[model samples]
Target: MHKLLPALLLAAAAALPVHAALPVADSQGEPLPTLAPMLEQTVPAVVNIFTRTRVPVQQNPLLADPFFRRFFDAPQQPRERIAQSLGSGVVMDAAKGYVVTNHHVINGADEISVHLADGRTLQAELVGSDPETDVAVVKVAAEKLSALQLADSDQLRVGDFVVAIGNPFGLGQTVTSGIVSAVGRSGLGIEGYEDFIQTDASINPGNSGGALVNLRGELVGINTAILSQSGGNVGIGFAIPINMAKEIMAQLVEHGEVRRGVLGAQAQDLTPELAQAFDLNAQRGAVVTQVTAGSPADKAGLKSGDIITHLNGRPVRDATDVRNVIGLLRIGQNVEMQVMRNGKPRTLNAMVEQPRATTVNGDKLHPRFAGAIIGDIVEGMPFYGKIEGVVVLEAEPGSPAWRSGLRKGDVIVQANRQDVADLASLRKVVRPNSPLLLNVQRREGALFILLQ
Candidate 1:
């Protein structure tokens, strides 16, 4: 009866009519202050971004047939087509003309333009973009523009009021308000790295790369996505925290790309079954399924089945947590990982590094590898039936490797009977004028290519 009574009470509460803001009239019969003053400051900082992309249309394969071409004279290759897209962005720097937006908003764009609030349009330059975090940096030549101030998003808590300003549905600038629904949300598969700030704001299409600010007119987040069924706003939206965006922006503005750290480990979320097998106290952590042989994780003595509990003193709730934390760290930084092995806790120190191909160039390089680009597999790279290895990223046209049936997507498994586990190992074994035998793993089967 106690449980049933609560359920009945909840049903009754759901039937109650919703109310608007409290105290429409103040005690002295004067209206309360509205958000207009704050919006006045923030809305101007949010601008519309227009982009153009040229995409080549693919032709039908049957048109390429010899008989069809000879008899009907197949039409020339399909001409390139133009596609346009629009989104929102926030001005971060007025003097330097720096603006921030979602990476996907300007992805593959050949031409970009920023539309200001004061009836001025300027061509925008893409400084850099990081798809893992879905943040991008753009620059314009304009000066004396309005800029929004970024707040410490880490200081935000659940239920804090936030306002979303964007060009939703290309309807110019729009404003919506809601509370922070949740924080530190991850594993939603929205992007390669997901540390989103969930809000109940009415975000919709074209809101991507817009400003999500607080009442103090401080930038708290960037509206990036929404969770809706009917393709309209349903009070569920996601924003990339401004702090993470700032981190990526700094790198993009300086280096034109984000340099992320690699921990050299493959991980997955711990399941209840795995938790029982490992005799864990709780089924909440990332399990190290495999560690690269010579990677930082391996050098730090991380082994398979070791459940990672924390990274650099931050609690790791799942494999996404581990990936996000490691992905954000700069290369050459040091990290401390806490893990549980055999029901005991241990700490390991590892240096975050970027994966690079051990290059063997000049005469010492293998002829079969001379024009092939190789690298370690990073996050979001697609592979067939495998997750780790030194992959052939590209092959120069008409190059020896390209002519010898070696193609991209081939994973180098062994070289001359020695293990070619990663880019580094492959470089170590490749030599000129040697009996080089490469064992490759393709979608079909394992085959070897011999080069002398």
Candidate 2:
């Protein structure tokens, strides 16, 4: 791509039409191609965002200890200090004063201020934010704002010319130009939900939540992160597609949260060896590994070993694709899936369902479980739809459960040496005034948490 850029630039130059009115021109007295025309229409929509948050200050272990603090007459209240940061945002609705930005920019912010291109600064409030997708919406009560038109990011292709507008490193309103390097990029581990548009645009510090626009000055993506080891732009940057952000923004504006649904199926990437073992000719798909009983997948007659080729009209390239598509859908929405079963293609339909939240008070179960909140595994929880078990929703600090090594998000799969899949099974295994034995799964590994 590095070598190809010069040729692309030359091709672009040759394709441009000359005009005498523009300031930039060729040696022959004709105007040269320039982005000034598009940028003039879009730059006002991009904004500089400043935020302040109050966070607890880390102290020494002795200061944290109650006995040591009492001996020295230290302050009982934890010390808090204000943190400040800067980023960018795009004004999506001029009339309503709606601005969209990255979740990380305003997360935990105590005060938010939006600075417009015209030098007006207004106080802002967070509408909603989704950390998994790293998208957020803020609302400011202001008039005469400029909003950028949204483009269909799905139509974007590799080599498409793009412009990044943001406030980089507190330098007000910087613009960078580059080509779309790739699309539909995932598995980057940068965000929990990712379908990024990879570009060579020079996204840098304070560029988060900026606008990535096309030649027509239409918003195509939101600048989110850059891939660099030295914390500088190295011709590799990522942006969340506007389509996905639009969806999340709507949900955030309406419900103050994203109501994501589940398909109740676990799948793995369809590898060459696995395809050969299954006697299939497929080159790209996700092989179904498990389907929960009574789930939408099971009710729709989806079975294990089925290879998913497409979801709705989108192609499934791997297991990540399958997960990404389903995770963005709203509850109660109908889904159509194309799968290959036994070397033949088939179509199945299922309605997305909301995961149930069944929780139990820990103190009611046993003395050892006091001060903890246990619940059934649901969507957004670790290992949801992949494992059947109970998860610790909350474990109060300095409590019995916390002292006994129990914490939030710990999936308890076994209790008293018996398989405990849900709250009922756990209840049946628990005994009053007895030591509790729990086989727990925490993120990537499993361990035993004993509460005596």
Candidate 3:
């Protein structure tokens, strides 16, 4: 009877005329809660992004053979095809027609078009993009565009109600509701700098670069990646905080690239054994391991054995936290770090420094390395302080180094079966006329290249 009474009451309430005003309850004593009002103002700001990319078509190895090509009279020019993909973006500045989206959305794109909720499609120009943070900005010439207000994402709590607005599966401006699952998520390997705001907000493939807003219709995050094995939404999703995105966007707009600052030190996560060694009771921090001489860290009096607890007033949980915080700051910015030296808390101020890589021509090292440029691994670079090796900064196409399977961004960790930690060590191992062997660390994996 109780269930039936509730159903009857619900049916009676349904029969009542719907009012424009919505609250927890109406004047007739009926419960009615809705997200319609908030979504009405937020959806228009979210745009649909379509990209067309021209990519080379792969051919069989036999087809590339000179003998086979001569016999079969294969086409001289390479075959190409156009690939199309869809994603979402947010209208950050309606006046300037600036739309912010994920870098992967328009990466390698030949043409980009933005579709508005008002049935308008405008061509967009790439303003700039930072692949490390996966943040990109595009400009479109449009009118009457709506923009969402940016909210303080740092103030967001785990239980705060949030809404995800995007064009999911090309369905056009879909809205999903969820609460903040977590904040300050890092070490995901999804991006170089990952301080993601994790949420269970049904973020899917086409939802990338969409807007994640709070209940007040204010933007808190930009939906970026999902953690689903089946490519479907399994409730686990991640977004770049608007605060972080805003900084990256500013640098991209100003310099067309991110000039990341460095702390010039290496640190590892604080372990229980290390905590005991340092006589510290807490486990959440990063222990400094090395400080480069004449660097910002060295100038600021940072030393090995110091455990960093906080940066710029925020708690540092591990090495990744330290990396992400410093990676986002621009050059010449001031940083405040709180560390424990000799079991005593100490505060230090340091200015972020511009990173410089010591580069050398490959011809000076070996004949096979001609036309390649090798550089010392500097702070703020990938694998900096994590690996000891010289990096191939550039390798010209059709050059001796390129023919020897050496490409740019390859870290040569070993030469002639001997450890080559830096350029000087590499020079000691490689003889001019002797056969050369290199153990290189590529982006995907490691391999050995032998040159005669």
Instruction: After superposing candidate 1 on the true structure, give the runs of residues whose Cα lies further than 4 Å from its correct spot.
Output: 1-27, 57-78, 272-283, 341-345, 357-376, 379-452
In candidate 2, which residue ranges exceed 4 Å CA deviation?
1-23, 58-78, 365-372, 380-382, 385-390, 395-452
* Alpha-carbon lDDT, every model: 0.85, 0.92, 0.92
lDDT of 3: 0.92
Please provide, for model 2 over 1-452, each residue's C-alpha lDDT reduced to its tens digit, 9 standing for 90 to 100. 79999999999998888653646668898878889889999999999999999987777888889999899998876688889999999999999999999999999899999999999999999999998899999999998999999999989999999999999999999999999999999877688788999999899999999999999999999999999999999999999999999999999999988898888888999999999999999889999998989999999999999999999988999988888888888999999999999999999999989976799989989887889999998765435656888989899987888888898879899998899889999999998788889999876789998878
Candidate 3 residue-pair clash tally: 0
How do the residues 235-273 of candidate 1 rate in per-residue lDDT, one tens digit apiece?
A: 889999898888888889889998887788888899999
Model 1 residue 326 CA deviation in Å: 0.6
**What ranges in model 3 sit over 4 Å off?**
1-28, 58-78, 395-400
Model with the higher lDDT, candidate 1 or 3: 3
TM-score to true structure, per model: 0.71, 0.82, 0.87
Superposed by TM-score, candidate 3 places the C-alpha of residue 17 at a distance from the truth, in angstroms, of: 14
User: Model 2 residue 127 lDDT?
Assistant: 96
What are the per-model numbers of colliding residue pairs? Answer: 0, 0, 0
